[model samples]
Target: MPVRSPYPDVEIPEISLFDFLFTDFGGRDAEPALIDGGSGASISFAELRGMVEKIAAALAERGIAKGDVVGIFAPNTPYYAAVFHGILRANAIVTSANSLYSPGELAHQLTDSGAKLLFTVSPFLDRAAAAAEQAGLPADSIIVLDAAEGYTSLHDLWGTTAATPAQDTLPTDTAVLPYSSGTTGLAKGVILTHRNLVANLLQIQQMGTVTGDTRILAVLPFFHIYGMTVMMNQGLHANATVITMPKFDLPEFLRIIADHRIQRVYIAPPVAVALAKHPIVDQYDLSCIDIIFSGAAPLDAELGHAMGKRLGCTVLQGYGMTELSPVSHCMPDDRPDLDLNSSGFALPNIVCKLVDPETGEEVGPGGRGELWVKGPNVMVGYLNNPEATAITLDDEGYLHTGDVAEVTEDGVFSIVDRVKELIKYKGYQVPPAELEALLLTNPKIADAAVIGVRDDEGEEVPKAFVVLQDGVELSADDVMAFVAERIAPHKKVRVVEFIDVIPKSASGKILRKDLRAREAAKA
Candidate 1:
């Protein structure tokens, strides 16, 4: 039996994302749609739509046609939103690369997505230009959002008098290409359609209490789906004011939140640790926050409760992957009493089945299994990688989420850990995410990651890589003792290594592959 959403299905419109978000402003035309947190610059809904029109007109004039893919490699900003919608308005697709990507990484995405043009800022020109060259795009194809000498600037694009192209995109048309390293492999582009994006917006609107008055703080990078759909698009659909930060600086982040009087703050678990324990957090008045919704990683329940207590707000969590347009299950804004560990009920139009990974047997409530999701928001397939797509999505159209999860009889779902990342200690499974979350609760530990490593007998065991707070002294023995007292023998940390920082992805996922490579180098 499939686990269906508790809420009734919401109607998704058969239109492009451009029509879904930019069409209906009404009284919000004069209101601020986006704001730059650093410079305090704002663009009203009317102004943003104008920019989108001009950029679309320019793109069409420059020969950008339907089905063409444009690349964006910039950080979070008010202009990012304009360009993002502008590409769609021109009936083109967008393949957004992580701003922190190197030339090789960006080039890989550009080449794979067959991007015809790129959008970036002046500060990132060096990397973007190098990637553009590697991807075989002409020098004239690069457009810097901020003025960069010699390159085509946003002002140049805005100078076009050409008419915006008519919307030719269908619901099935591909919208955005975001790369994700599925269950196990190299990074591959996840093909999200316009219908997928529009479906998620309608689905999310029913879960969160985001109204026109809500202020969303978008510090997360828009290249990732968590930021793309959850923070940016969701804000636009609700007609909420979205404040964008180019990058994360602790002091700057706090100041922006305090200054903007933001109501809804969406964050990954890493930021929650800072909000809960960082001494500098006391300097800011964050009582304006009404809901701190966490996604992208499993948040520790204790840390979530601590942050909520300190800030006097509701702390909620959600679960999704890049393949799911990033959200299928989330705690409703009103359900503050729900356990922080659970991702709450499924959104409308989603059916989930928990199946045993090894046996292929369906597991009901109270049993752990790989979560297979069937929904309208599920991605059609991986871009140009049929083999990979076939491995993930089944004949039934359910995406076999590589993550293991459990559901309560009441329909509450809790994500356990990635099936591939789970550690096997003497045949007993030990979840690294659980260990990492527990490590974050320690007062002296700043951050942590756990991966399975072979001991002297070639037996796999959980080894912890810890990042200590500045000026704090701790030994490997001390760390081992701390964990040994906490859990079962099989789950105890057998090896401990302290480092300056834990390698993590842009979305705050621990880059265990990098850690595994490091261990392999020693071997």
Candidate 2:
């Protein structure tokens, strides 16, 4: 039997994403919705709703119909929320691409997602144009977020009259296609339906994290699932004033928190580390902050507690994946007495179980196993990859999370380790396979294996073990520089070790455990 959520099931409405968010905005129309952290510009709820409809009409005018995949390849801005909902309102799927992706990386996602159109900012126009070209998308298919000399601004798409596209969207229809590498392999599109996103939003709302009066500081990148749901959607759903920062600059982050009197902050582990130890934090007044919630990756208990003490606020953590519509377990705001290390109880209507990996049997309370979950928040499937979908979601609809966790007697879940080979670098996923493939492209490199190794800052980084070809002369800096030019900065190879061979199994799979042991011996 699966462990049910301690909380009662909340009603999930069978409605489209747009209706769920904007249907009851009459009273809150004049309220501030999204405030630009940099320029102090803002959009009222009324203006946001109108812009969403106009952008939808613009998309329809451009011949974008239902089921078409549209890509957003820009950083977080107040306009991002408008464009994202507009794509959904047009009955199309929005696939958000990382702003830091290189041309090649961006091209792969665009081609794989079968994106018919792309929305990007002017700063990324050069790479976006190159990627669009590589993906066989014409120049006209690209729209700039900010108006450029030859290109039209996204604002231009809005018309004075609100036009609603044909209402063909179902609750189960895929709404967002955020890509994830699942447990292993290259990144694949995760199919989150309208119901999946709405269910998770409702589930999170029941947790009582965000209230109507909550002032949120959103510095987390909207491209990632964590920020999309927690910071952007949840903040809007609760009618909170969300201050949007395009990127995370520590000094700016502190200043905004102080200036805006932000009450709630949602961040990842690295930022938590900074808050705990950074000297600059003492320079600012963060007294208004009520809660600091950390997700995306694990937060060390010691660091979490330290940060709470330093800021005089409640520090909490949550757990989820891109395939789970991003949140399954979170520390409820009402339950501040729970252990900071645990990810907290399963959200309402979510069923969680711990199963023995080798025996494939359910574990009792306190026994460790791969965490399996069944909930409305679980994704529909992986786009264009039925095999991966089948592997992740079983016939009974349970998602194998690939995370080894233990549930306490009182129903708290704590992640112990990962059963998969993917590395979490500062909350950003760095798949070893993606890095190894790039390493093999070098003429001097004969064979390579990549693994996550801890740096002095206690953060995970990709470390490459290279076996060079005969008579090849290459320095570690040369190898690192080679990869840095071709991939995103976060995925760059930070540490390199020359080895005689890359240990592998008989089936030719890389023995990462053996490599990890060797690294442990060195430490």
Candidate 3:
């Protein structure tokens, strides 16, 4: 069954990202495209245009064309954007890899996406090389971030003489392929066409969040759609400067805010938690920050207000999934007085409804049910996985967000819980089952269950509730150390506690909400 959109089939223009980047808004010869706070690096729109052109030409020279996948295994740098636009200019798909991913993690994504080219930074050269090799991606297709090591430099492509994209119009062309965080299962490739990207950019901006003068802190990793579309696309679409970071370091984040006089912040729940509870946050001058938007996880109203009170600004939270181009609802920048708990009104051109999971019937206002989203920003479908796509995005085009929420009569919505069992650590998805499967393999572990625990920062961290085997002594530290080596940094179980038995329902499913209640009571 084809997923149907709830939005009225209005004759909206299907503008391409290329058209938006180089034409309708700011074109090739505009002001600076990006600025790096860490290294004071800046690239003008003209330079960015040149870089994209070269990469497009280079891809053409390599026989890559429309629909080819290019893996960008790097951090949040100007080169990242250049390559992203470069891939789109060539009518190819851009799939991003988390810089912190191990070789095994990277290999899965590359192979799943069938990536033909890889752009990687120097720091993770070994991991990227291994991933490309493991995925059977040709060595010749591997392009090093730098040129000194005999690999092609994306920078060198900037000056090369070659024809610009032969196909300039890219309305329906697929531009980016971002994978699900795979918090529940295997990550699936999401095909976002130029129209998908452009519509989302417009939708975010239409929410009245920022202006051309706005300066956003680009701390979120660009690999995720939350950062890729909301941060990179929204920033560029508004002709704003993005301050890039390799990773989130508290001290550095504060310093960048003070240095850049950042006006807006787009961050995840973990970052917001740090701002609310971290002792060091008080020492820095965050007066310039006007708006802070937290997403990728549920943020309690109490914590959201605390951060706003401490920072003396408005704090907003959004709720959505990777399958929806990330932005479904955001606190309208204009409606700062709205309840902080609500994910806020749906963006323009988006229609959302709550349906009772048990009955599949639409729940009225103030009624709790699973969130169903419909908009142009919703994805085309999962790449090469029709079965999963059908399960997630229903026949009516209303994507079952797998999140439970209630919409008030005023149109504001607040999320109660997720129907899914995915745990979010610092805004990154960490599946409990995945961790449980890994833990059961340990000789000393008899039974294990993973649940989220809110730290002092008000962000959830993976905490293992375990019952060790008889005659085996497994310390909490031992359990923590075990997961650290096997998974990505965000997926590591930071806290471990002994539990005699994990409470299960009559059907033998772990009672996670009950566990959450117990944990909260203890806290």
TM-scores for all candidates?
0.83, 0.98, 0.90
Tens digits of per-residue lDDT, candidate 3, 171-193, equal 77777788884325566788777
Worst ten-residue run, lDDT, model 2?
A: 155-164
At residue 333, what lDDT does model 1 achieve? 90
Candidate 1 lDDT, tens digit per residue, 1-523? 7999999998888998998898898589999999999999999999999999999999999999999999999999999999999999999999988776768768989999999999999999998998899999999889999998899999999999899988899989999999876665556899999999999999999988898998999998898899999989999999999999987789999999999999999987778878998999999998899999998777879989999999999999998888999898999998988989999999999999999998999999999999999999999999999998999999999999888999999999998856777665543346687688778888899999999897884557899999999898889998888877655455789999898889989998889989998999989
lDDT, model 2, position 283: 98
Q: Would you list the clashing residue pairs of candidate 3?
A: 4-397
Worst 10 residues of 1 by lDDT: 422-431
User: What does each candidate score in C-alpha RMSD?
Assistant: 10.2, 1.2, 3.4
Model 3 regions lying over 4 Å from their true place: 1-11, 25-28, 168-170, 181-183, 277-284, 443-447, 465-473, 497-523
Which prediction has the highest TM-score against the true structure? 2
Candidate 2 collision pairs: none
User: How many Å off is the CA of 512 in candidate 1?
Assistant: 11
